[model samples]
Target: MPETPPMTPPMTPPMTPPWTPFALFGALAVLAWGAAALDAALAGGRWPGIVTGPLRGAARELVRQRRRTVMPDVPLVRAGVCALPAAAVLAAVVLPLGERPVADLSVGVVWFNAMEVCVWWALWLTGWGVNSLHPLIGGYRFVAQGLAYELPHMFALITAALGAGSLRVSEIAAAQRGLWFAVWMPVAFAVYLVSAVAMAFWGPMDRPVGSDIAGGVRAELSGPDRLVFEAGRYLLLAVAAAAAVPLFLGGGVGPALPPWLWTALKTVAVLAVLVWARHRLPGVRMDRFTRVSWLVLIPVSLLQLLVVGVVVL
Candidate 1:
C-alpha cells in the first residue's frame, strides 16, 4: 500500500474575553444602594423606613438648591466630588469578577494602589475648593490621615503580592484557591481592613467629615451636588469592601453557588461591617488615630510583609 500523508493537528481558537463589564455596572449600582441603606440602618434601622431613607435623601437633595461659599472654586469642587466614585470604579476594574477582571492588567495590584492614592487628591480639592475655614481644616485633616494610613496600606498590599508571586488580581485570586491569603497573612488582612475604612474616611477615620467641623470637607455641598458626593463616598466604601474578597477572602471560590454570586455575597458582608462600624465604634480623633496608624499599624504591616516575603522565598 502507498504511504499516506501524516495528519496535522488543528489550530485552537483564542479565548473570547469579557472585555466590557456591562453587567458589573449593575452589580456595582446595587452595592452602592445597599451600602447607602446599610449606613441609614446603622444610623437607625427603622423597618421599612431604612429602605426608603436613601431614596428620600436623594430626592430632598435633588430639589434643594446648591450651597455656595465665598470665593468657591466650582470646577474644582465638581471635579473633586466626582473623583471619589471615579477612583473607586477604576480601582475595582482591576479586581476579578469570577476569576477574570474587566481589564486584567498584569500589574493590577499596582493599578489599584495608584487609583486609591487619588483619593488623597480628591478630598484635598473638595476641602480647599470651598474656600471656607472649616473646609480648609477638613482638607488638612484628611491629608494628615492619608499620611498615617497610606504607608501601612502599601505594605499590606505588597505582602499579598509577595505571597501570590504575581501582581495580577486574578492570579492572586487563583493562588488563594487552595488557601485564602487571610488564613496565613492575618496581620496584612487586619491592616487592610483598617486602611480600607481609613482611606474611605469611614467609621473611626471620618474626622475629615466629623461633627466638630460641621460636616467638614462636605460642609459647603448641597442639593444634587451633595447627593452625588454622598453617593461617591458610599461607592468608595462598597468598592473597598468588595476588593477584600479578591485580595484575601478566596474571592468567588465558594462551592455550590455561582462564582459571581459568591463574590457578591462576600462583598455585601464586608460592606455591612464597614458601614456598621460607624455605629459600633466611636469616631477616633485624628490626633490619637494618626499616632496609632503610624506607630502601630505601620510596624505591624511591615512585619507582615517581611514574613510573607520570607515564606515566598
Candidate 2:
C-alpha cells in the first residue's frame, strides 16, 4: 500500500539506575577531602583561609578600634572557638575507623549521641566567643534549635539500637543481612534524616547562620581559626552521613562490592542529598522551626520508638 506509513518503532523509556545515598557521600567525601588537602597545602597550612581571612582582618581592625563592645567574655569565647575543630577531628578518627564487629561496641549508640551533644556545645561556645551581640543571639538560637531536633534524633537512634538488640553500629548493619531497616522502619529513617539536617544546620534549618539577620556567629573569625571551623562543618556532614548508612540503611548491603565500598557508596549518597537540599530550601524562621520540632518531630519520634519496641518484642 503506497499510502501505508512505515510502522513507528516503539519508544522505550530510558532505564534509570536506582539512586542511593551512599554514592553521594562517597563523592562528597572525596571532594571535601581533596579540597581541604589542597587548601591546606596551597595556603601554607592556613587551610580555612578561604573563609576566615576577611573575618580575621575584621577582628584585628576591631581590636585597634579601642571602642567598647558588648559581647560575651573573651576567654569563654576562645575556648568555644577552639573546641569546634577538635570535635571534628575526633569524629573523623572515631566514626570511620576499623571494620564492622571490630569497632562495634555495645555502647556505640550512646557514644554517637554523646558526640553530637558535644558538637552542639562547641558551636555555642564559638558563638559566645565572638563576644558580640549578633554572635550571642546566633548562639542562643542554636541552643533553641538544638532543643528542637536533638531529642527526636536521639530517640530515632534508640529505636534502631533496640531493634538490632545492640548499640553497636556494626552489629546493626549485620542484623540487616536479609533486609535493611529502611524497608521496615521508613518513618524512623525519615525522622532521622530530618534531624540530621537540622543538627548540621543545613537547608531549612540554617537560621543560626542566617545571612539576613545575625550574619552568623563565625562572622568575626579568621585565619587558622576560621579554617578549622569550616573544616569541622564539612567533617560533621561526612560523619552524619556515614552514621546514617550503618544505622538505618543496612550498612553496605549489596552485591559485587566489598562491605567498605558499599558503606562508602551509601555515605556518599547521603552527603549529596544534604548538599542538594542546602541548595534547594529557603531557611525556616527560628520561631517556625522551634514550633515544628516540638509539635511534629518529637511526637513522631516517640511513636517510632514504640513501633520499634513492638516489632522487636
Best by lDDT: 1
lDDT of 2 at 198: 76
Compose the digit string of candidate 2's lDDT tens values, residues 165-265.
98767678778888888888887899898888777666678777678654676666655555556656666766777788888888877889887678777
* TM-score of each predicted structure versus truth: 0.92, 0.76
Per-prediction RMSD in angstroms?
Answer: 6.2, 16.5
In order, the Cα lDDT scores of the candidates are 0.86, 0.68
Full-model lDDT, candidate 2: 0.68
Tens digits of per-residue lDDT for model 1, 7-41: 74433322326544775667777898988887777
Task: Name the 10 consecutive residues with the lowest summed lDDT in model 1.
Answer: 8-17
Candidate 1 error regions (>4 Å): 1-20
Candidate with maximal TM-score? 1
